[model samples]
Structures are given as C-alpha cells and as structure tokens.
Target chain A: MATTTMAAALGSGLRRAMEDDPRVVLLGEDIGRLGGVFRVTDGLQRDFGADRVMDTPLAEAGIMGVAVGLAYRGFRPVVEIQFDGFVYPALDQMVTQVGRLHYRTGGTVRMPVTIRIPYGGGIGAVEHHSESPEAYFAHTPGLRVVSCATPQDAHTMIRQAIACDDPVVFFEPKRRYWVKGSVEDEVLDDALPLDRARVVVEGTDVTLVAYGPLVVTARDAALAAADDGLSIEVIDLRSLSPLDLDTVETSVRKTGRLVVTHEAQRSGGLGAEIAASITERCFSLLHAAPVRVTGFDVPYPPAKLEEHFLPDLDRLLDAVDQVMGRQHSLTGWSA
Target chain B: MLRSDVSDGRALPTTEEPPDPELVQLLAPDGTRRADPVYDAWVEDVDAERLLSLYEDMVVARRFDVEAVALQRQGQLGLWPPLLGQEAAQIGSARALRPDDFVFTSYRENGVAYCRGAAPVDLVRVWRGNALAGWDPWAIGMATPQVMIGAQTLHATGYALGCAKDGVDSVAVAYFGDGATSKGDVHEAMVFASSFAAPVVFFCQNNQWAISEPVGLQSRHPLADRALGYGIPSVRVDGNDVLAVMAATRVALDRARRGEGPSFIEAVTYRMGPHTTSDDPTRYADPEVREQWAAQDPIVRVEQHLHTRGALSEDRAQEVKEHAEAFAMELRDATYGMTAPEPLTVFDHVLVQPSAELERQRSQYAAYLAMFEGTSGGDE
Candidate 1:
C-alpha cells in the first residue's frame, strides 16, 4: 500500500490507463509541459511522449469536439475541461454529440471518451472556479457522472470510468486534491462497484449522504454526532447520474431518516432529486422528510464570503438534527 | 451613417460579381473547356467513360433530391434539405475520396452519400422518421448527416489527428456550407487543425443562400480567403464544373494523404431550392439572379462537356434517365414501406450495459404497457 494524494492518484490512474491501451490519448490545454493547473497529469507528457499526451489549443469546445472525433476513429480520448465553470462552451458538443452518438448510431459506435473536470469550490478561488455544475451533466441523458472524495476512490474510479464503454464525466474535487489516503497499488476493490454508494460510517438514527468534497465533511459530522449519542450513518455517493439509490434507499429504510448535502445550489440540485426519490421509495419508512444542507440558489459567492456560502460540518449537523427530529438550528423560531 | 451603410438592405449577393478571374474552371458554362495549367494534369485520367459516369451521378442525385422533397411535401417524411443545384460540388469532391477516407457532412449532400454507396433506404431512413442513423459509419466511412452547422469540422480534424497517430494515410474530410464558416465551432476547428497540422480537408460549398439570408451577410471576403488566414492552403473552384471540383478535391486529398497537413477548398455553387421542405425561398431569392444561374446548372454543364467528348449517345442518355427513375422509385417505395419500431426499444442502447436504474424504469414502463394490454380499450 502506498500513501498518495488525490492529485498523484489521478496521475497514476491516467498513466495506468495509457499503459494498458495505446488507443488512450490525453488532450487538454497546458497539460503537456505544465502538467495541468492542478498537476493531476504531472510527468505524463514526459513519460508518454507528445502524441498520447497532447497540449490542445485553448478552446473547450474544440477539445471536446476533437475528443468526439477521436472516439469515432477508434481512439479512446481522455479530455480535461480544465475547470468546472469553463465547461459551458463545450455543452453543445457534450449533449448533442457525445451523449447522442451511441443511441443515434444504435450502439455500433461506442464513445468511450473520459472527460475529467476539477470541480467544486473550497480553496477560496474567484468566480467560475468554485462552482458545482454536476447537475447540468447528471441531468443530461447520455453521460455517466461520478465524483471521487478520497485518494483510493479517485484512483480506482478514474481508471474504471476510462475503461467503461460509454462517455463518462469524471469530477475531481479541486479542494480535496491534497487529501491523502493509502492506495493499494493497481488494485480495485471488487466490493465497491462503480455505480454503488459506499457506507463510510454505519449508524442507525439518521443517514447523512454526500459525495466529492462533502464526503469528508459528512464523515466528520457523523463522528461528531456520534459523540453526542446521535447515531448518524454517512454514505459517500460515488455515482451521481444513475445514483446508487438502491444503497440510499436501503439506508433510509434502516435509519428511517435522511439528509443530503452538496456545494451546488438547492433548486434543481442533485440533493432535490435524491430527496424526492427517497420520499417516494421509503415514504412509509421515513420518520421525517429528507432535509437538505446546500448552498443558496445564487452564483457561487465571492472568495471572501465563501465560508458562509459553502456547507461544512455545522450545516450538515444541522440538517442531521432536522431529519432526526432534534432541536439544533432553524427550529420553531419566528423571525 | 448606419442607414447610409446599407443602400437597399444587407448586401444581397449580386449574380454579376465581375466573373472571378481566380476561379478554377476545367469546363466553362457554355460547353467550352478551359485548360487549367495546374489542375489539367489532375484530371488527365478522366476519359469519355469516366466523364459520363460523373454526369450520371449528377443526374441520379438530382432525381433523389426531387423525390425526397416530394416525400416531405406529401407528409411521408419529416423534412428534407434539397441539394438541387450543388450536385457537382457533392459528387465531384466525394468521388475523389478513397473508400478508407472518412467524411463528416452537413444535412444536404445526398450526392456525396450516393457516391459513398448509401442505398436509397439508408439515405432516407432518418428523414422518413424510421431511424436516427442513416447508415453505419463503419460501413460507409461517413457519419450521420449533421444538422448543427459547422460542428463536424472539429470531428474531421480530430479524426485526422487519430489517423496520423495510427500511422494511416487516410484523409478526413468535412463538408459544410458558406454560412457555417461564421460559427465558433468552425473557427475553433480551424485553430485546432492548424495547430496540430491535422490532415483535414475543409470543403465548403458556397451555396449562396443560407435559408433567407445571403452569403454576403456572413462574410465580406471570399470564403477561401478566410481559410487562407489560418495558414491552410485554400482554393476557389467553379462549383458548377464537375471536372474543376474533382480536380480541386483531388489536390486537397493528395496533400493531406502525403502528410502535408490540412487543405481547404471553397466550391462556389448556388442553392436552387428552399433550405428545407418548410422554407420559402421566394421571399428573398432574386428571380433575375436565379435566371442567370439557371444557364449555369451543374448537370447542364456536365452534360454539355459529355456531349463534346462524344460520350452522349441516345441509348446512353435513355439509360441514365431510366437509372435516375429507378433510384427515385426505390426511395419512395422504401420510405412508404418502413416498419414501425417497438416502444420498449427507447430504453435500449443508452449505455453499453444499462444501469439498474434504467432497468427499473424500463420495467415500470413495461408494467404500464401491460395495463393497456389487459384492458378492452387501449390508447394507441
């Protein structure tokens, strides 16, 4: 077992996929010599040479559209969108072409293009850098969307996502790049399926669900709640699109309460869909409606006021308290 | 000042643009043959039989277009983009490509599809609402007809990049109209193609009108000049001349296959029909300009050239007419006889392996369908 940061794990994951298949080509801006803005692809260009690892012109649409073409020519293209907020320029290609190719072609042409984006804000960056835009792609029909919170999950999930025979939108938590964990070298845990939720901590009172950066926060919230005699179950939802709702439904069935949290805005967020689906699935079993701990429905605030904007242990704890029918915050106070 | 900038309105492209001296032409409009110094050797292999075959291609493709428009008008198909006047632009360039070369095309270019061996059924599959894909990409080396303007240029560039990496000499071609040149995707495609020196042929058929808007509204300079700014070798050809178009495309294809990087060709043609079955061209099209272009039709020029070469016997002309009639009949029959697809198939092929969530939804939908099956009355 080797201890690695999320960034290093991602680098190794890319390296492994390239080593396994010659068809895998990496394309992005500043990725060749600079190793990308976050260094997730550090030393790849040196090892793989310029053909497999390409420094593309700085155009998100061109990068994505080129990736689609590469896939058509039987090359497994791995594209880096650079950042989450900058992906809007490539949305038309993603939705109309990448997402529609397989269905439109009646399964003859498999996309197999892995698009990586360093998403979410907690590093106190400026506008467009700190936004959570997973919902836009998750809501799209043709994409498989996932996020990795830990180094181990980051390594295995990125590898599996690349190996999959469909287009995958792989989200990496930009703030959690330095987070470290022991990665079993080149080993993928068979028990932890790609489309299933992982139980980070098992408890009974309320289920606290989160993914990406918030998984670590929710785990801390559960530990803190444990000290207060509140048995909170923390589930790290790895896949966002075909959400491992079976795992969430099972947890909700057992705990009888739930809380969902994310950095993205509340309206039309992944949390809203989770809450609604659980309400329908475990309606009789639910003791209280699933509570949401999320950012307000506004643009990601300026860097200075981000702490107030982003959800942390305190907010998640409050959501747990609300779902558990306990008095914590926002309880029966008339303003 | 803004009012004075426009005398009548947006600059309507005049038919009398002082006959372009730079335009490459092997066959002139009046049955006259011009010998181009550089391109004459390119088409030295085109004998009497080869020239007649090109004439036949133009004839058959025009018949297919007429049939498709009639199908759309009769409510048998969803919509059809007619390529009435640009037959040479499509057939000439497409015939120059090898079978291994891939093509990414716009919604029109039924002639190109014809050259690529697309059956009448395959060509009209999407328009008849029978299927999303017109034909398999692997089989024909061409992608599904793209409706999004200028999007496929990037695909062609990227495909060329892949071909270069795979150590193959097959060229990747992109076919679009003049209006598509103004799109951001097209601009980005050029930047990427130029930066990587990808072997892509950007074939833009300057088919004067984009719906009701004229090409003058999109670009002031020649479309080929726009490509020249990107450092890609550019050429302007007389689109109505089959031999000229064939020569230009062969030059571009040869350059790309020789690993000399991308080339751009602007075939200046004219759109003779509405943009689609739904558009009304009479609103904006100039009758006088249309009449002037009528004398320069793509098929007429090819027929004139074929007659000069002693290739137009009465029996052969009758055979070509019969072939075109048969082509139109096949499309009409196949379109009318298309089988309806199953409703449950909508949930299929979204993923290589359907997720458990998709399976659940499919089952739920199946149960809903079961309810109607069990009842006496059903909603169709």
Candidate 2:
C-alpha cells in the first residue's frame, strides 16, 4: 500500500485498465502530451503510446461521437471532458447516441464508454471550469452516473466504470483530486459494487446523505456533531443514477431523521429526488421531514462567492441540527 | 425548389464556384458511354452481366421505396423517407464496399441497408413501431441508421480511427446528404479523419434538398469542393450514372485501403418524390422542373443504356421487374403480419444488468400488468 492523491489513484486505475485490456483506449483534449489539465491521466501517453491515449481535437461532440463509434467497433473508450461545464457540447451525443444505442439495438450494441469530468468547485477557476452538472446526467435515463469521494473509491470505481458494458458518466470531485490517502495496489473482490452507497461515518441521531465533493464535508459535520453529544451518520452515495435507496432506507430507518446535500441548484437537483424518495419509503419511521442543504437555484456563482455557495461543514451541520431538533447553525454565508 | 439549378435542370447552382468540368461521367443521361482514362479502368470489370445486375439492384431498390411509401400511406408504417431518384447513388456505392467494411448511414439508406444484407422486414421494424432495433448490426456490418443528421459521420471517423489503432485495413464509410455538410458533426468528422489519417470514406449523396430547404442554402459551391478545405481529395460523380458512382467509390475505397487517409465523394442527385410520406413536394417543386429531373431519372438512364447496348433483352428486364413485384408483395405481407411487441419489453435492453432502481420498476410494472390479467377473462 502507498499513499496517493485521488488524481494519482485515477491514473493508476486507468493504467491498470489499459494494461489488462488492449481494447481499452483514452480520448480527450491535451490528454496525450499534457497528461491532463488536472494531471489525473499523467504519464499515460508515455507508457501506452499516443494511439491508445489520444489527444483528440478540441471538440466535445466530436470526441463523444467518436467514442460512441469506438464502442460500436468493440473498443472501450474512456473520454475526458476538460471540465464539467464543457460537457454540454457532448450532452446531445451522450444522451441521444451513447445512452440509447444499447437500448436501441436491443442489447446487441453495448456502449462501454466512460466519460470522466473533473467537476465541483474548489480550484479558484473561472466561471465555466468549476460548475457542477451532475443533475443533467442523472436525469438522463440510459446513462449510469457516478461520483467518487475518496481516493480508494476513485481507484476502484474508475476501473469498474471502464469495464462496465453500459455508458457511464463519471464525475470526479475536483476539490478532492489532490487530497492524499493510502491506497492498495490490488482491489479486493469483495469491494463494494460500483453502484452501492457506503456509510463513511456512522451515528444514530440523523443520517446525512452526500456525494462527490461534499462527502468530506458531511463526514466533518458528523465528527463535529459528536463533540456536542449529537450523533450524525454520513453516507457517501457513489452512484447518482441508480441510487442505492435500500442502504439509505436502512440508515434512515435507524436514524429516523434525514438530511440530503449537494453543490448543484436545489431546484430539480438530486437532493429533491432523495428527499422525496426517502420520505416516501421511510415516512412512518421518520421523526422530521428530510432537510436539503444545497446550492441556490441560480447559475454557479463566481470564485469569490463559491465558498458561501458550496455546502461547507458548518452548513451541513445546520441541516443535521435542524433534523435533530437542536439549536442550529445559522443558514447563510455570514454564518 | 430543391436546388437553385431547378430552372437550368442541372445539379449544381450557378454560383461563384461553378461545377467542375472533370465530374466523372462514364455514362451520360442520354445512355452514351464516355470513356475516361482515369476512372474507365476502374469500371473495366463491370461486364454486361454485372451491369445488368446493377440495373436490377436499382430497380428493386426503387420498388422497395414505392412499396414503403405505400405502406406508410396505408398506416402500416409510421413514416417512410423515400430514396426516390437516388437508387443508383445508394446501390452503386454500396455494391462497391466489401462486407467487412462497416457503413454508418443516415435514416434514408434503406437501399444501402438492403445491399448490406438487411432483410426487407428488418428495414421497416423501426418504422412500423414494432421494435427499437430492426436487425443485428454485427450480422450486417452496418449500424442502425442514425436519425440525428450528420452525426453518423463522426461515428464513421471514430470507428476508422479505432480500426487504424487495431491495424485493421477495413474502412468506415459515412453516408449523408447535402444539408448534412452544414452540420458541425460533419465538419468535425472531416477534421478528425484528416488529422488522424483515419481510413474513412465520406460518401455524400447530395440529393439537392433537406426536407423543404434547397441545397443552395446549405452550400454556395458544389458540396465536393468543401472537402478540399480539410486536406482531403474529393470527386464529383453523376449520381444518376451507376457506373460513374461505382468508379468513384472504388477510387475512394482504394485510397482508404492503401492507408492514404480519407477521401470524399459528392454524388449529385435529385429527390424525385416527397421527402417522406407526410411531405408535399408540389408545395415547393414546380411541375416543369420536376419533369426536367424526371428525364434524368437514375434508373431510367440505366435502362436506356442497357437498351442501347443490347446487353440485356426486354424479356430479361421484364423477368427482373416481375421478380421485384413478387418481393414487394412479400414485403407487404411481412409488414402486415408484424405483431406488436410485448409492452414490458421496453425495459429489457436499457442496461446489460438492470440496476436496483430499474429492477424495482420492472417488477412493479410486471405486478401492475399482472393486476389486469386474471380480472379480465371468464376463462380465468
């Protein structure tokens, strides 16, 4: 075992995937000579050659359409959009072609295309670079959407997503890419399936559901709540589309209080679906209605305002406090 | 008018860029065979028997189009995009391809699909709303026809790129129309194909119209000229002349197979019928102009050429027509007999392994369906 960042873990996973399957290929802009803007695919081109690690033209639709075609011809393509905001150009190809081909062809054509997007705000980048666009992909029916919180999950899930026969939209939390953690070289066979949710920090008073960049914040919030004699459970939802509602329901059944959180706009976001679904499933067992701590229903704010916009530990604890019927942390940027 | 050249009865409009005088023409509209030093050698092996077979292919394709349109009109099909007057362009180029060469085409390439060995019933499976997929693409080496305009061009480029990486010599061919050249996907496809030197053939049958829009709106010059901007060689062929189309396709296929990168072909043709069964060509196309194009019919020119050469007898042509009629009748029967698929089958192919959410929904749907089963029948 060696300590590594989420980015390095992803690189190792990609290397392992390519080493195991000759049919696995990578396509993205600047991925060949530049590794990647975030360096998640660093040194891959030097080892795998330019043909396997392709530096595609600066066209997202072209990259996506080409990836779908590669999948059509029995190649598993792992494509990278430079950032989450730029994925819009390829959304049509993903939703219309990549997602539908398998369904359209009645299971004969499998779209084993893994699209990686460095998403969520953390780096002090410009407007388009740090946006969270998971809701768009999660709403798309044919795609399997996922997000990795820790380096270990990132390492394991990246390979699993590449090997999956269906198209997967993988969201990498940009904020956590460089956060270092210990990782094992060999993945255990008993590792959780790519779509299951895991409880990162367990407690009893309330269950706090989070994913991607906000999982760490939820964990921190749970730790903080423990100091005050309040127990909070933090659940890291790995898959966003086929939500592991059974695990969540079990946690909610124990806690009887729920809080859902994300960095996207609260309106029509994954939080709304989680809150409504949890309410419907565990209504009789609940003590209070599920509270959603999410970003505002507006465009992702500028860099200076992002810290306030993003769900921090204090803000998440506020939602947990509200569900626990305790004195809450004030809910605003000033707090 | 489908094109600005409707009044002149020519395929290209009189723009700042005129039609290339070097347009490959082995057979003119008047049934005169012209010998070209460059392309004539490509078609030398097209003997009288092969020519007759090519003519029969076009004849049968035209029959299929006529029958599909009739089926749509009779409500047996949801919609049909008629490939009228472009039979030679589709069949001629498709016949030039080896079975291993994959084809990515727009929804209008039923003729190419047929040549790729798609069954007649499979062609209408999607149109009849019976199934999401009509046939297995792997079995035919052709993808399910793409409906998003010009998108398949990118797929062709991508597939060829993969083939190059795998060291496969087989080429990927993209079939689209004049208006599709205006799409960003086509431009991106050419750029990628050229930049990577991927073995791709962009076979564009410029049918002079995109629904109601004229080709002039899509291009100021001949569509073939646009290929030069991307560092790819191009050819403009008489789409009505089956031999000319075959020669052009052979040249492109040869270039692609030789690892010389991509090539483009603009098969200039006209749409003699409505864009689909729902369209009314009379709304925009003038009768006199349509008559002028009718004189240059792709199948008619082949028939005239065969008659002038005495290569095929009238009895032989009649037999082929009878054969096509019998196939059309079979198509009608197959279409009428197609049963509606099970309602629950919609959830079958969404994923290789159904997710937990999908599984719950499928079971709930099954239970809901089960609710109606025993309550309805006296036999129960």
Candidate 3:
C-alpha cells in the first residue's frame, strides 16, 4: 500500500492502463510534456513516449472527434478536458457522436473512451475552472459518468473507466486533488463495482447522498451531526450515471429522509433528479420532503464568495436539521 | 464559370490515357451508341447481372427519395433533403465500395445510405422526430449521417488514421457536399489526412449550391483542386456521369487500400431539387439554370446510352419502372406503420447507468406526464 493524493493516484492509474494496453493513449491540451496543469498526467509522457501521451491542439471538439476515430482503430483514448466550462466546445462531439455511437451503430461499435475533467468549486478558482457539469453527461445516453472522492477510488475508478467498453465521463473534484489516502499498489482482481454507491457511514436519522467534492463535506457534516445525537447516514455516489439508486432507495427507506448535495447549481441539477427518484421509489417511506443542499442557482461566483456559494458542512447539517423537523437556525451554534 | 488556374495546371497526366475521357459515358444523351476503349477493360468486369443490379439500386433509391419528399409535403415528415439529380453520383460511388470499406457521410447522402443497406423505413425516424438517428451506423460500417457541416470529414480522417495504425487494408470514405469545403473541420481533416498519409477517400459531391450560398462562394477554384494544396491528388468528374464517378472512386479506394494515402474526388453535379422540403430554390436560383441542368439529367443520359446500345429494351425499361413503383409502395407502408417511440424511452438510454440526478429528473418528468395523462384521461 502507498499513500498518495487524488492527482497522484490518477497518474498512477493512467500509467498502469498504458502499460497494460498498448492501445491505451492519452490526448488533451497540456497533457503530454507538461503532465497537464494539475500534474495528474505527470511522468506519463516521459515513460510512455509522446505518441502514447499526445498533447493535442487547443480544440476540445477536435480532441474528442479525433479520439472517436482513435477508438474506432481499437485504441482506448483517455481524454483530459482542461476545465469544466471549457468542455462546452466539445459538447457537440460528446453528445451527438460519442454518446450515441454505440446505439446508433446497433451496438456494433464500442467507444472505449474516457473523458477526465476536474470539476466543482472551492479553493478559490476562476470561472470555468470550478463548475459541476456531470449532470450534462449523465443526461446523455450510451455514456457512463463517474466521480471519485478518495485517492483509492480515484485510482481504481480510473482503471475501471479505461476498461469500460462504453464512453465514460470521469469527473474529478479539483479541490480534493491534494487530499491523500492509502492506495493498493497491486491491481485487485475484483475492484468495487463501477456503477454502485458506497455507504461511507451508517445512520438511521437522515440519508446524506453526495459525490465528488461534496462527499468530503457530507462526511464532515455527518460527523458533526453524530456529536449532536443525530445518526446521519452518508452515501458516496461513485457513479453519477446508472446511479446506484438501489443503494439510495435502501438508505432512504431506512431513514425515511434524504438530503442530496452537490456543488452544482440547484435548478434542474443532479440533486433534483435524486430527489424525484427517491420520492417515486421510496415515497411512502419518506418522513419529509427530500431536500437538496447544493450550489445556489447562479453561475459559479468569484473566488472569495465560492465558499458561500458551494454547499458546506453547516449548510448540509442545516438541511438535515430542516428535514428531521429540528430547529433550523444555526445563528447561535458553534462547531 | 470553371476557373482556369484550377483547371490549367492540374490536369491528369495525358500520356497514360485517362479513363474514357468522353465523360466516361456508359449511356449517352439522344439515344446514341458510343464506346471508349479506356473504360472498356473495366466495363468487362461489370457483367450483365451487375449492370442490371446497379440500375435497380439506382431506381429504388430514387423512388425512396421522391416518396420522402412527398411525405414531407403531406406533413408526414418534418423535412427531407432531396438527393434528386445527384442519385447517380451517390449510387455510382457507393457501388464502387466493397462491403469491408467504411463510409462516413453527411446527412444528404440518403442514396448512399440505401446502397449501404439501411432500410428505407429507418430513414423516416430521423425526420419524423421519433429518433435522433435513423439506424445503427456500425452495423453497416457507416457512421451516422452527420448533420453538422463538415464534422464527419474529421471523423473519417480519424478512422483512416486508425486503419493505418491497425495496418488494416480497409479504407474510409467521407461523403460531403461542395458547401462542406468551407468548414474549418474539413480543412483540418485534409491537413491531418495529408500529414499522416491516412488511408481515406474524400468524396465531395459538388452539387453547386449550399442552401442559398452558391458553390462559387465556397471556393474560388474547383473543390477538387483544393486538395492539391495539401499534397493530395484530386479528380473532378461529371457527377451526372455515373460511370465516371464509379471509375474515379474505384481508383481512389484501391490506392488507399494499397497504402498510397488519401485522395479527393469532386463529383461535379447539380441539385435539381430544393435544399430541403422546406426550402424554395426559386427564391435564390435562376429558372434557366435549372432548365440547363435538367437537360443534362443523370438518369436520362444513362437511359439514352443504354437504349442506343440495345442493352435496354423497351420491355426491360417498363419492368424497371414497375419494380421501382412496387418498392416505393412497400417503403411507404413500412415507414407509416412504424410506432412512435414511448415517452419513457427518452429516459432509458440517456446513460448506461441511471444517475441520482437523472433518476430525479425522470421521476419529476413522469409526475408531470402523469398529471397531463390524468387530466386528459390518458390521451397523452
């Protein structure tokens, strides 16, 4: 076992994939010699040569479009989008081509491609750098969307994503890149299922569902709630698409209350979907309306205000308090 | 007018004898008999059975195209991009491809789609709003018909690049219109194709107009000549001449399979119909221009030449017409009988795994749908 940050885990995972499969290639801006701006791909080009670790032109659409072709040739391309907002230029290719290629081709072609984007706010980043756009990909069919919170998940999930026959959007929480954890060096023959949620903590008061950067916040909130004599169950949704709703349903059924959280805007966000699904499947079991503790319904604000804009431990606990019919005001509380 | 600089310096070498320079005429206008020795060798490979099959394919595709336009007129389809005059260009090039070759096409190549084995009924789903795409492109080794201008060119180039890496003998052919040459992706595709020496054939159907924009606006030189700038050889043929288009495509495909790299062919044709069912060409084009192109109709030339050669008898011609009509009727029945996709289908394929967000949206949408259903007594 080795202790590593999320970014380092990603680099190790990418290196393993490249070593395991000759067809596996890396393509994106600043992903080659520079090892990407975040250094998630550091040392990859030096180890694998330039052909395998390609630094593509500053065209997102071109990168995706070219990757589609590369996949057709039996190459597994892992593309890195510089930022969340910058991925829009490649949206057409992602939606129209990558997401639909398999079904459109009657399952004859497999787009074994992975798109990696560091998303969500916190750490005072500028516009376009910190934004949660997983919902957009999760909304597209024929694509798998996943996010990693822990370093272990980041390493294992990246490998799982590269091995997937379908295209996958791997959203990495930018703020969690520095967070460290123990990573298993030897490849596990059986890793966690790529599409299921993990119950990080067990509780019966309220089901706290979160992913990516929000998972850390949710776990912290749940710990704080524990001191307040509230057992807040925390679920880390590793996969955004093919949502492990069974896990959510089970947790929601037991707790009879659900509070979903993410760093994206509230309106029509991933939380909205989670709330609706839980209400439909676990309707009679719900103690109160499923609430969402998410980013405000506005563009990602400036660095200084981002902390307030993003869902925090207090906000998550407040949401829990509201759902459980407790005093909502945190005015006099000190953690 | 055809530009001189585009034509003057870029003519095919004269010494080896160009492939039937007489427009590669298999059938001539005015019902006359004519034969060129250059293409005679290739024509021998096209036996009586193959010739009849080619004719049948063209007829069926043309009928399908015509019926689609009618369907659009009757509001059965939202719109139809008619490939009326350009049937021969598509049919001829499509026939040149083997089953192993892959094709990436622009949205207008309905004829090529038919030849590639997509059912006529499948085409209706796209225009009828029942599906995002008509059929599975991979099943037929054809990518989905790309709607965005010139985007497929880059895809085709990438496919070709992959083919090179795999050392596969298969070549990828990209079908686009004259208008697509103006797109940055197309230019970039050309650059990539040339730089990598990717095995590809860029088949550009120069149909003279891009919606309201004339081909002249898209290029100052011939569309084929634009390829020469990238160190790729290019050919321009009378797109109305099916034989010429077929011959040119065959050569390009063969060269690509042999690892000779990419080639571009500009099939100079005319779009005798509107840009789409919703468009009105009368607003932008001259009546005289249409009249002139109509006189040079692709099918008419073929029929005239076949009749002169005694290869097409009056009875055989009648049989072809009857078959075409029967095919059209069968397609109409199949297309209209297709069921509109279920509303829930919208939520089904969005992702391989349902996300918390998607589940939420799906449930909310279902609730909204239920409210309407309840109010309308399940009508929705």
TM-score list, all predictions = 0.97, 0.96, 0.81
- Those runs of model 1 whose alpha carbons end farther than 4 Å from true positions after fitting are A186-191, A328-335, B1-19, B374-380
Tens digit of per-residue lDDT, candidate 3, span B1-380: 45333435564211111122434455444434346565555556775556666777778778888998888788788888999989889998999998878899988998898888887677777887777678776667788788888888878887887787777889899999988998877877887788768899999998888997777667766678899998899987778777767878888888899988999998877898999988998888777777777776777777666655567877888888888888777767866888888777676654444455667788988887788765756755
Q: Give lDDT tens digits, candidate 1, residues B1-380.
A: 01123345664443223145678988888767898799999999998899899999999999989999999989999999999989999999999999999999998988999999999999899998877889998899999878889999999999999999989999999999988999989989998988888989999998887788777777766888888788999999988889999999999999998888998999988888889999998888888778777778888877877788788998999999999999999999999988877888998888887988899999999999888984777555
Q: How would you encode candidate 2's per-residue C-alpha lDDT over A11-77 as one tens digit per residue?
A: 9999999998999999999998899998988999999999899999899999999998899889999
TM-score rank order: 1, 2, 3
Q: Highest lDDT: which candidate?
A: 1
Best by TM-score: 1
Candidate ranking under DockQ, highest first, comes to: 2, 1, 3
Every model: iRMSD: 0.8, 0.8, 3.1
lDDT of 2 by residue, B198-294 (tens): 8999999987788878777687667898999999999888887899999999999999988999999999787888888889977776667567667
The most accurate candidate by DockQ is 2
Residue-level lDDT tens digits of model 3 in A1-335 = 99999999999999888888899989888998899999999999999987788887677887788788888767898999999999998888899889887766545668899999988888788778888988888887778989999999999999989988889999999999999999986464688888989999999999999999988899899899999999999999998887888899999999999999999888888899999988999998889999898888788899999878888988888888888888655654221
| Candidate 3, position A229, lDDT | 94
C-alpha positional error of residue B170 in candidate 1 after TM-score superposition, expressed in Å? 0.2
Ranking by lDDT: 1, 2, 3
- List of chain B TM-scores, one per candidate: 0.95, 0.93, 0.90
Tens digit per residue, CA lDDT, model 1, A1-335: 99999999999989998998889999998998999999999999999999999999889999999999999999999999898999999999999899889998888888999999999988988889988999999998879999999999899898888888889999999999999999865655573777788999999999999999999999999889989899988999999987999999899999999899999998999999999999999999999888888888899999999998789898887777777677556554211
